[model samples]
Target: MNEEINKIRELLDKIEKKNDVSEDSLHGTFDYFELPQIIASVIDFLQPLLSPYESVIYWFLFRHSIIETADRYIRVSNSQIAQGIGSKFKSGDKVKVASDKAISDNLRCLMEKKVIVIVGDTNRDGTLYKINLPEEIELCIERMKKSRVENTCHVEQKKDLDYYNIAENRLLIFERDGYVCYKCRKQLTRFSATLDHIQPVSQGGDNSYSNLITCCLHCNSSRGAKPIMEQFTSDSKVF
Candidate 1:
């Protein structure tokens, strides 16, 4: 009887292991978002401002540090960046790959534009760079705000706050709300996210950051001009 009981236990363990494996195979291989999706917002915002070579180099470093290595910083040589991005040079007779000087110049240009920052001094291995997506976006927003404020009086600035549409402002709202829809409590990507006015503009809402909230398109549209506090109170959902 003892021997029979031990055999049954071993058979049960095998069945459980097989079920776990089957479940993992069915569901564990898929993910809704990856590195590319996470970085898509930065790309969309900066694409128009970057040159062809600058964009290529940026993507190469982004893939290496963020996608391939899952790191926020990367050490890379100018030659490596040039080769990875297919920068070319004109030699005496044929078109050769970019020289280190050309690559260095472009890297410096990126640094000047605040797109990349040098994190470490040049060493025998390579120079380290930290990508500056969020910082760059913030800087862009600040510059625009400053320009607007300087060109107009405070009253005009407050009345015409169209800068709310800027990428940086949107990102700030999303970050403040933990990237979840205020109404539905669903996670949102930069692409799928929209901003809603807690106080409807039709009522008295201005474009001040405090009056804006991150929301999904469905919630933003469905809310229409309804007061947020009333809706939340009726639904018994705490904002």
Candidate 2:
């Protein structure tokens, strides 16, 4: 009886894939000439609204489906997202894949936010998804309008616009962390505060804002490549 159910499920998935192949092809002729503009919008607008996990999963799907192929539809699984996306936990010495349940929940959250749509049924291969671009998403559209982004097919990349390496993005992190050492609780200025990775980069941690913490130079250097320091009690502790 189990075997019969499995066969039926497989057959249905195959049929769904066959039907969606045309849907994918409809986008095959799409001119991706304006991709850079869309990329800028995703970075500047859409990304800020998504949770860290959702951002990682969204990028993974975007890279695999839209960037790798012209197809916006990609088939993926919760395990695939958990493994493919970069995340590290301090559970053990070795880097570990994020919990599958976290990925699944974030995927649902993304759908609820209308960032991605489930286009087809699931199978052994995985479920099919259609990634919605920033321009299509309501939140991004509002941001785009408020930013007064002119109607142009071309967009120039801004200086210091990316992660902590960039001046603008670094300032964002400092502001978010309140310019205080997350580990030692020491207050710091932008010039003295350095960003520390929650999960060390050596351990597969990413530069997402969620993974970054502000710390004084002493704490940043002292905690280098080590597990997070114990929460220090002295907010006014010097050095």
Candidate 3:
């Protein structure tokens, strides 16, 4: 009687495996050793290979166990990927849809890297992607972060040259004009300050420090296409 009961139990187990379709069941059967920490590590490593949008899409798949987030009937396209990447829609027919291509390409790349696997077809409708964490992913993530930091540092250094030059010019202009708009005595913010040509650049004025004066935006805009002297005189105003 015990042997018959054991055989029945084995038959039930086979039925259970055959009928299971839930994500948990699939995971338990195929990747029984997977833990939340390992999944997180995989995402962290994958982040660098992806743009912000791609990273979002990749993680969404891992956490929810669903691919092709949009309606499958909508026909996955590149524009959808661009939408995910924050691009404005040109039209449904414009080029190819970005969302479909981006997801497909990234999935292929991830598979090639062995960070994930195609376990099976989804309900006979879509691909069942199983997530995995591998050592190369972690290493690749580290290298990408380092590259980003270096690139950021280089941009900052380039910007500093113009910033310092602007600062030095401000000091000289303040000394020359007593730190006020020549006409209004208004204090200037950086945007409010402008370098007006003493003589018009079109009328043979050279682009040199000595040939310019720091003027306010109000004065500059009011000056228009006319020379400064002509502008103030034409309007009969102090601007």
Candidate 4:
């Protein structure tokens, strides 16, 4: 019995040593934040007013500037926006591809709804869009509230996957992972981090919080469709 007890104690000690090494190695690679409560409030308020396409585009821009870049204004071309939101298109011989026209239409709609504004004149480069946060859209929120009351019975329900792509969920996943890449254990900021699925969607993974993790772009792209364990072997060095 004493021999067994000593063995167990030795195993526990080894585990603690390993944990200490991990913490030391990852000391500067993770960052923690007080989750931004405003993101949730903003997304909830706007969900009712936005069409599916509008919501997708808005969220994409929100992630790019507000979350990833930490900028109030983002300069983007219609082609860029279209690509980000997975807009479909087709050439004479090719299948569906990105549509810049669709992106332009959505931008115009968002501007008309006062959810975004053009910061300057359109130039050869691209348009600079100033994204309106929750506090910045008081009037639009009021109008949306009134419209919701008027059309209470006609509310639209979106899919779970779509909901997961909103700013709020993205923030939640970032916070949950301490803003570090799960695979490489590298520290990241809102602008530099991306959410990756432990199980690839093509392999039947869903977008639940349990399935999502914050990853740096390189690790996320490199680990595509590969098993998670393959990236974290004993011989691997994150740096």
lDDT of each: 0.66, 0.71, 0.49, 0.65
RMSD of each: 13.3, 21.1, 24.2, 23.2
Candidate 3 local lDDT, 174-193, one digit each (tens) = 33443356556565523245
What tens digits encode model 2's per-residue C-alpha lDDT throughout 68-181? Answer: 887778889888888788776666677778887888899999999889998877867889888887655767656755554352112223322345676556655665555567
Better of 1 and 2 by lDDT: 2
By TM-score: ranked, best first: 2, 1, 4, 3
* Runs in model 3 lying further than 4 Å from the true structure: 1-44, 51-54, 66-99, 122-124, 134-239
What's the true lDDT of residue 53 in model 4? 83
> Which ranges of candidate 4 are over 4 A from the true structure?
1-35, 88-93, 143-239
Index of the highest-TM-score prediction: 2
Q: Candidate 2: minimum summed lDDT over ten consecutive residues — where?
A: 151-160
lDDT of candidate model 2 versus the reference: 0.71
Q: After TM-score superposition, what is the CA distance of residue 131 in candidate 4 from its true location, in Å?
A: 0.2
Query: lDDT tens string, model 4, 1-239?
Result: 99999999799767744543422232333232422554664566675678888888888888876676555567778877776777565668776645667777877888888888876545455776777754346454464345445543332232254314776567656655556687777766555678887767888877776667788889888776965655677887643
Q: Give me candidate 4's TM-score against the actual structure.
A: 0.43
Clashing pairs in 4: 29-187, 68-191, 89-96, 89-97
Q: Number of clashing residue pairs in every model?
A: 0, 0, 9, 4
TM-score of each model, in listed order: 0.46, 0.54, 0.31, 0.43
